[model samples]
Target: MSSQLLPRLAQEDESTDALSGPQTVTRQARPLRFITCGSVDDGKSTLIGRLLWDTKAVKEDQAATLRRDSTGQHNELGLPDFARLLDGLQAEREQGITIDVAYRYFATDRRSFIVADTPGHVQYTRNMATGASTADLAVLLVDARAGILEQTRRHATIAALMGIRQFVLAVNKIDLAHYDEAGFQAIAREFREIALSLGVRQITAIPVSALKGENIVLRGDDVMPWYSGPTLVETLEKATQRTGQSTGFRLPVQRVSRPGEGFRGYQGTVAGGSIKPGDSVVVLPSGVEANVKAIVTYDLVRNAAVSGDAITLVLDRPVDISRGDMIAAIDQRPQTGRAFTARLVALSPDGIVPGKRYWLKAGSRRQRVMVRPVSALDLATGNWDDAAVLALNGIGVVELDFEEDAIFDAYETNRETGAFILIDPDTLNTVAGGMIDSRRSRSGRFDALPDADRASITLPARLIEAFLKTEFARAHVGEIRVTRGEKE
Candidate 1:
């Protein structure tokens, strides 16, 4: 949104915790995954870095190095190494900005986190889409001084488009802006309106100073006195993790765990719901059915495993199951098809053109697809206009006609199974990210509108006659043409 320049700061001390044992109660539990996106220099990296440092998620040596390498010479005068915290790449280090999706891991007492620090620059929107696609929640940072900028709006709109409605709108850098109540409220109001317009109902705006380590992991006494809400860390811990509910159990069988050492089983994270031993399963896109003989983890045998658990499964009868086949519950089998329609954001500069071929990736399954552009919407203006091609950051609707069939649910029904991305076959770079709008049923109701009645009701009789005459002539059928001549 706002073009906030990178300011060189004097060096500062970044205190951190010593890495210890597993932080959460759930044994071998996976961390909550989230992506941060907003205007340039909105302090996304700094916020996350602070959270990790305060929560003892960072290793001691790494934290020490980060502190030593901070911007300025004196600890008090030095600027925090916020950008360097997540910009682990050499190129990013040299550029002093996040270039791609920099993934990092951290943990707290209540939960662990896989933070995808996405780039805020408008040019690198594709990277943002990749990071946000798998996120359970989107944390949007807004500079208190600048308020809601274009990039912030664009990121929020994209997150919503990608089926992410939960947002933590961090009004960051409040210290620099003097923690002005009016400034914080102004920015919050602006972003609230934008988030609401973009269909985000649950957004919590917190005034935070990521640089000063205020209201991030630990609540600060310096911010707005009127505000009384959970700090960023508290809020994140309280947020519910996303998982789809279905009677059907699905695991996009990754690879038959190479029958090594008397072990021939399917290895994959449960894509949706839970699966147990003795449950009837169906391998979809192939329509083969089998009963689960055993749900095996590496160490112990599990009667049931929930979604997100990576384990190998054994079936009673050997069936033709492969990498792409979706192993779902027999009774509640998900819809499987070769073609599907979706709302997509074209990530490339050349844009998405109709009848263009791209590699479609859903879960672990891949297919060559021909995208038929149904329509294109301008992200900045929300205008639905048709174009031969959709450019970078262009949001629109498209129908992906795939060469092979695969199982998928609606995004609203299940985000994990309902989302997908398009990749360039040549470059192998992702070109677009999409969400399947589940509201529309299989029937084509919108396309089957009573156009004749609508036209007659809306148009004048003279214009309707002219339209009918034009259509009849176009049809080239000899008929009783009741026109103005018959009336006369």
Candidate 2:
């Protein structure tokens, strides 16, 4: 590969941009992060290696070592075993499978990329979730010979649940299938059905032979001219970043910095909407109100701060705020509750034990929680089946019982504040990764009254009986209503 290809890859077609209209202005070129995942021996490493090799991201010396290691294992094109580039672990090489997540960084002329090659075995589904949690897109590879396997659906389901909308189905090993276009289309159609059922709207399918370096970096027009679409590199450069949280300002206090006797600052990353000086914010759980005094950073005092920024916040008044408490917008605050419902992915060997106490960590807060599995997700059928316990690598819905008042937003509204991990108290290992679906209460009461006020409010017996008789109220009523009599 020549270094000259770099300039050629970076050059965009002027006509295409003009036809598409003006491009959105970006402050910086944030690398598009993605992950490659699917069943074992699906050519994930080979696809990534082909991408790096054709783009000249691999140095000559590294290629020389690959050639020496390959020995008699070179393909018909005389290329070295591309899988060797990513199988860094001795165990992985010996087993001929990816056992852990392998991350690789590479850049094209137009954009940079960070790709995580995740393991495909069912036992390592937790590793796949870890990579997909932060990815903007997921590239799922399927063997041309084996259309859609159980593990393929498992990866897709996990990726979609992690909030990845953009998907690329690379039908790898076209050469073994005689480069049959019909075979590729059949697999693409079946996968599209599964993707749509999972609520994924954006999908792109491509046919390629990773070992032969076809339709990966360079187009395989000579082999399959009938299939005309952007190459794998083009799909990545054009993909957009995940949208920011559309909720009100949120800052989960990581630490209380008290450098001086009279000065106290809350330090954390902005998890939601932007915040500015003088903004009225409320401390969660305690419900103490404070005004933003200053937005402090290492560089200087910033006028405003948006999501993804790590900074120190100074409140105007002395308030009872501490680590694990969330500082949110005064009017639009997140839900505070003692119980909630969430979807969890079991990550440990022992799996999730129902009615067991575990430490749940979300953002900077850690609290004791008891988990009760309600139902498990059927990946193949996209159905929820009754389950009493979640096994290893199993995904299920559960009820979370918190020992204290917990503050959180729906995972769909804010990924940062809604995501959490469960740790086993005895083993001290991560047992599950969970996302908050909604808050739940035994009494079905979610009013904003104080604990004392709630205890005092009582509903009339007649009103309760009448309300329960109504058809609409029977299934949906979750709150008690009471009104005082008016003076005549």
Candidate 3:
């Protein structure tokens, strides 16, 4: 509840050979962050409502209101309409579908959880992506009657692409299937194939009925005596949080704090690794190095702070540092380049256009960039095929050309430093979410640069740093030599 960032426990997500792997005595437990997703009418909102309801998170007043809302209507079980608990929007209530991401918090005696109930409609894929971006795990639901649909696979692909290794395939509405164990197993098996192919190893597929409140937090063993596996809550209780900060130190400076005279500090959340007083640090994009003078916070000055910790850092010497510059470990600086390969989730109705100039913001830095679609992923086949443009809800790989130097680590290596968003200049709305694949040299992407006339006119002679990174400069290294012209 303290607004400061977390010192999250690093727990390993152990993979097993089988998809329906065994749950063990929890090696670790802590407050977890996760999301629920899948195709439409998969009972995602109902599952979340069931989770909250079973955990006693719903107060008496809320329950009474829900009962009043369901006075005339009757479900198959004559129970409270669980979906209404989260589908608070008028449109959602009228249409009986979720349109936006609704977040809910609940806890068990064993651990706590923060669950984001993302929409299942294809148009709301961007909303789902926003929820999955920060989730450590994904709860992908499926209809026991329908098995795995195209959208189910799509949601799994997006979640895996966002680096969620732990997945729970909730085969919902089992009661509607007449409690058919064979049907549940069949659906669970197919989903495992998809999850494993995505490089996700830890998967727990459970049969559930959200409306009946079976197999969610409490056991449905009375009905499903064959399923000796743990309940959904049990699986979540022992599930591990992703250790996403394996890469070395990285800090994207948010702002320079000067609370009083003679006290200058850099404030930002530590994105990766750890930092301590006297640590050697480098201000990126400028390559100016300094040592840590101190680490300050509202709490007592600490000797060290790890990833996700929000604190102010005082450097040993005065340096040209500001918002949008990275303060990273001197020995482990992130890749700085003018071009990079990235995978993108096209989020807007207009889709992502080729050669369009948009604001590309990664971490604290925002700059003009030209994006070129290379290939889009076929969700059904999981193949990367040639693509000229990314349509809405399309997942594609593209190359990003930056107008200025950009710093990032591969998203597989560091999520915080490697992820970025594209903002349309005209509307100022986010159009896409991109994950860095690898930073490329300017020459690596022949078409990443704009037309020479437009480039030359738009960029001034003062943009010499970028000019030096151009293909011509690298290609004619011996002919084109750089010498510092003295200050005029």
Which of the two candidates, 1 or 2, achieves a greater TM-score against the reference? 2
Clashing residue pairs, candidate 1?
1-149, 1-150, 1-151, 10-72, 10-78, 10-79, 11-72, 11-78, 12-78, 351-390
Which residue ranges in model 1 land beyond 4 Å of their true spot? 1-30, 56-60, 71-79, 108-111, 218-223, 256-267, 296-302, 382-388, 438-488
lDDT of 3 by residue, 66-118 (tens): 99998888686778888888998999999989999998878877678889999
Model 3, position 159, has a per-residue lDDT of: 96
- Candidate ordering by lDDT (highest first): 3, 2, 1
How well is each residue in 1-488 modelled by candidate 2, as lDDT tens digits? Answer: 11111111221432121111223322225677899999999999989988989999889999999899899988888888888888899998778788889898898877888899999998888889999999988999999999899889989988887888778899999999999999998998898888888787677788989998888888999989888776788777666667647679999999999999988899999998888999999999999999999999978999999888899999999888889999999988998999999999999988888777799999999999878888998877778999988988888998888889989999888889889999998888999999999998745332322233333345666876786697656665555444555641
Segments in model 3 whose C-alpha atoms lie over 4 Å from true places: 1-30, 447-488
True-structure lDDT of candidate 1: 0.74
* Number of colliding residue pairs in each model: 10, 0, 0
What Cα-based lDDT does every candidate model obtain? 0.74, 0.84, 0.85
lDDT of 1 at 64: 80
Can you give the TM-score per candidate against the true fold?
Answer: 0.76, 0.85, 0.87
Reference-based TM-score, model 3: 0.87
Residue 74, candidate 3: Cα error in Å is 2.9
Worst 10 residues of 2 by lDDT: 1-10
Clashing pairs in 2: none
Which pairs clash in the backbone of model 3? none
